[model samples]
Target: MIKNKISRGVLLGILSISVDGIAGLAIFPVLLYYQPKELAGLWILLTSFSALLNLAQAGLGPVITRMATEIKIDSTDSDIEKYYLKVNYCYRIVVFLVFCICALLYLFYIRDVLIKSNYLSSGIIVWAIMTLGYCLKIYATKNINTVNGYGELGWDKLIQIVVTVFSNIAYVIGLYFGLSLIFLATIFFIFSLVYLYGSKVILRIFVKMPKILSRKKINFSEVLDIFKQSLKVLILNLVSVIVLNVDILIVERFWGLNVIPLYSALVKIVTLIIAVSLLIQQMIYPYISLSWNTGVYKKARDLYLKGLMISLITSIVLSALLFLTAPILIPIWIGYGNYLGAKVFGPLLLFGIVYTHFHSHVSPILATGKKTYITPAITNGILSIILGLLGAKYFGINGIALGNIIASLIPTIYVVISTLRFFKTHSKYGGLANGEYKR
Candidate 1:
């Protein structure tokens, strides 16, 4: 029965990820062909920038997942209900905070871009709508995390599949008709609301919270405690963004917006490849978390190793395919002008491979509730930024890509060695030491 459930979860995860990957690829072409290249570059820049807004959540989703998993493993139904209510209350506060922050950010920064583009009226309205939409999606994340904690992995992916397909279809159709960027933004906002409400309905199917129970007041102390636990995760998240997604901002500052279309194409392809490769680790993470929380340390170690091996194989194969075909396929996909030549592409490919290799292992360590990965992540981000600036100043794009390769190499080695040692210590010690093993 356990194996069957895992098999089903794997199938669902693959299906959802496949659709998401295809949607992402499909949107890339539409973006390039339909919009002006500079505008296309700006759109990509904005999309990446929006990801930074996730910082406002302070990495609460994973903390919720871990906490809920523990409760599910060791507590009663009433306990589960209490925890869910607390999480739900905390998320509402986050939702409001996110909306206000996004609004202030747009008033100060994004508004200037829209004004420069001469789309001030439409753009401001679009930004406002999108901000609210984004907040709604943030609020909805609790529902998904709650579902994941209960070990309903397949159902969790099912909700995402529905949301991704709906939103992507809206985007493609709007873009195909030559709709203004504002219209597309408006549709994005609309679908976010759909996702928010739709997920609540889907979550009820697996686990329902009674209306009376949900109305009970939540303790502020619980909210404060969850926030405190998420502090390390928030740091990890902020630096991860700097390491992985801030390249375009750096490129714009040094090389100018004109080059971003070319640089972002390379980054996009690599980002997509990395996302697909990480599916194995993502699929197994919940199980690893449960295993460690239940004191099944050996099973957790074995699972981490198995997941890492599979992820490594997937990444290498995909990277090799990309390396071989990119010179030909990229030109055909986004036009010859956008292709970043082999010299620049090679280092980024190596960077992706090395980063993926370590991340695949380190994520499992995090699942064990170890903070060992945080310091390495901080080091990686700092070195990558420093090197990235120096490289962009000297060697152009190739230099920046090379900087990333160097930045990641040390952290990669440290993480892998540390991961092995972590498991070995657990094997000898028999259970997690200290407060790391929450019960």
Candidate 2:
């Protein structure tokens, strides 16, 4: 039954991820053919920047999900309601802070995007609209995550598929009509609203909530403790943003806005491939967290290892196919002028492979709720930036890709080694009997 549940989740996840990835891929050709290349780059940067702005979420969503999952295992209704109260209170505060930060950043730095804007008013309006939408969406994150925590993965991914398909259809139609970028951002804004409502509906279906959940007073001390537990994950998130998303900013700085379309496309392709490859791990994440927390150490270890094997295999095969086909596909899909050749593509390919391995290894450690990977993550982010800056100054785009490969490779090795060592120690002691952890 558990296996069936996970399989169904993976199927649903594949559907949602495929639609989003297809939409992501389709946008490049649509933009390049109908819009200026620089504008395409700017839009990529805009989305990246918007994602970075979500650093305000402070890594609390997963923490809350894990908390709710563990609580629901044995806790009473009132206890669950109290947990919900605390989580919602904390999210409200965080969401408000996100809004303020977004407003201030737009006032000070984000508005400067107009310097690159083909449509000045639309750029500002779209960005502001996106920011507001993002702020509104953050609070819903906990509820969406809680649905997953309850093991309603189909429902969780169903909401994702609905929102993604709805928004992408609007995006494609607007692009076909040669609509302005404002239309794209508006689609995203509307998607957020839909996502919020959908998450709430799905969550309520799984967990029966009391009517008074909204009216309960919050305890700031409990919120503070949640923040304390979240600090390491918050650090991990910061590093993740740097390693995964900051490259475009670096590329734009060194290579100029005109080259961003191709570079961002390469990154997006690698990202989509990685996302597909990690479906097994994603499906098993809640189980890993629950098993590890409940002291089923051997089960958690086996599940993690199996998921890692499948993820690595999927990533390897898909990446090889992508690498082989990219040369032929690039020119045909987006035109010869936009293709960057094998130099840029090769290094990023290796980077993607190493990064995939890193995630496969790192996810189990995170699911265990241990801060084991924080130092490695921090090292990765710092090393990647330093190497990227030097590589950009001396060797150009290939250098940046090489930098990513090396930076990602190092931390991946550390994580694997650490995880193996820990497993070896526990296995010698007969696994779960000695490995039960406090929730």
Candidate 3:
């Protein structure tokens, strides 16, 4: 069963992400052919908006994954089942409300800024709709994946591929027809709906029978506890996003919106590599959650090490490829003549990618244990902002990239040391066999 899960999960992940990359890559050609400047501006706007939307997600997807795994392990407990459903529903309600409110506030309050910035007027509205669609899709999909990570992934990948293919085709058609950004945004929103519907259908197939709602109704105290738990995870996600994304935002403001497309293009290429790493990380999360729940600490630890090694090796190879190809690829891909020497940024950003990959793997492990506050509060939150600001002011885009490298290093190193120390102490105390973790 374990082997089956791993094989299917990895394959589906690779398949889904490959389609995602192709779809993403297709946009570059569209941008190059139609509107290069707007393309750059759109890149910055989309990336920034994506970061904000992710912040709004507040890591609930992983929380759902954890809860679902727990319920599956203790499936015999009717009370546990009831409580899980109640929490799940409550989370959905709260997240939906919060996302809507935040989206509205941004739309109304920041109208002037967005307009003056020349971002598509309807972009935020489209984004809000898409965000809701994404939340629903994620909630359903996370639970399905947690219950049976491998089995459901095939369907998930197929849905994604379909969406990607259609979306790109729509973009090309829209561009050919001289459609506005608002129209393009609408097309994207419709694509999200398709994904949401597909995910809902898949979810229905896997949900257990005799579904129970909590006998103890969700109350103020329970809401507060969930919010409190979510806040820690939210902060962690926010800081991580800011550390990873703020450079582009800063560069957009300071350097020019035009620089963003070039940088975003480079970042996207690197993200393709990271996405594969993330797939492995995502596959590992449920295993870690289940192993921890069952008191299989050694198994969890071994899994962590294996994921780390894979991430490191993969990141190294991908980074090397980017470093070698950036000079030639950037000009050919985007036709930005001024970006000739952008390859210099490749190696540094690769460091950020490796750190990011490591951080991604460790974060879920911490979150599964519900220990979310430590990394963000201690390492990422304040320090990253200060370093990023200082670096951008002094050194430009490369400086900003360097700032990320530095900021991420501290947290990544700390987590590694702490994890290793934990295993070492456990081994010394005869907590593991041959001082080695179980598979």
Q: Please list the residue runs of candidate 1 whose C-alpha ends up more than 4 Å from where it truly belongs after superposition.
A: 431-439
Whose TM-score is higher: candidate 1's or candidate 3's? 1
Candidate 3 per-residue C-alpha lDDT over 83-115 given as tens digits, one digit per residue, 9 for 90 to 100 = 455556655765575567456746664454456
Candidate with better lDDT, 1 vs 3: 1
Candidate 2 per-residue lDDT over residues 1-439, each given as its tens digit: 6688899999988888888888788878888887887788777777876556667878775687688778867788888788888878888888887888777867775567566454567778888888878876887788877877776676767887888778878887887898988988889889999989988998778876777766767778989999888888788878878888767878887877778888888888888878888888878988888886777777787788899898888888988898899989878877887788788887887787788788888777777787458889899999999988888888988888888777887788889888877755554565475455454
Per-model TM against the reference:
0.92, 0.94, 0.86
Worst lDDT run of 10 residues, candidate 1, spans 430-439
Poorest 10 consecutive residues by lDDT, candidate 3: 430-439
Better by lDDT, candidate 3 or 2:
2
For candidate 1, write residues 394-420 as lDDT tens digits. 888788888888888888898888888
List clashing residue pairs in candidate 1: none
Give the total clashing residue pairs for model 1.
0
For each candidate in the order shown, give its overall lDDT on alpha carbons: 0.78, 0.80, 0.63
lDDT order of candidates, best first?
2, 1, 3
Best by TM-score: 2
2 against 3, candidate with superior TM-score? 2
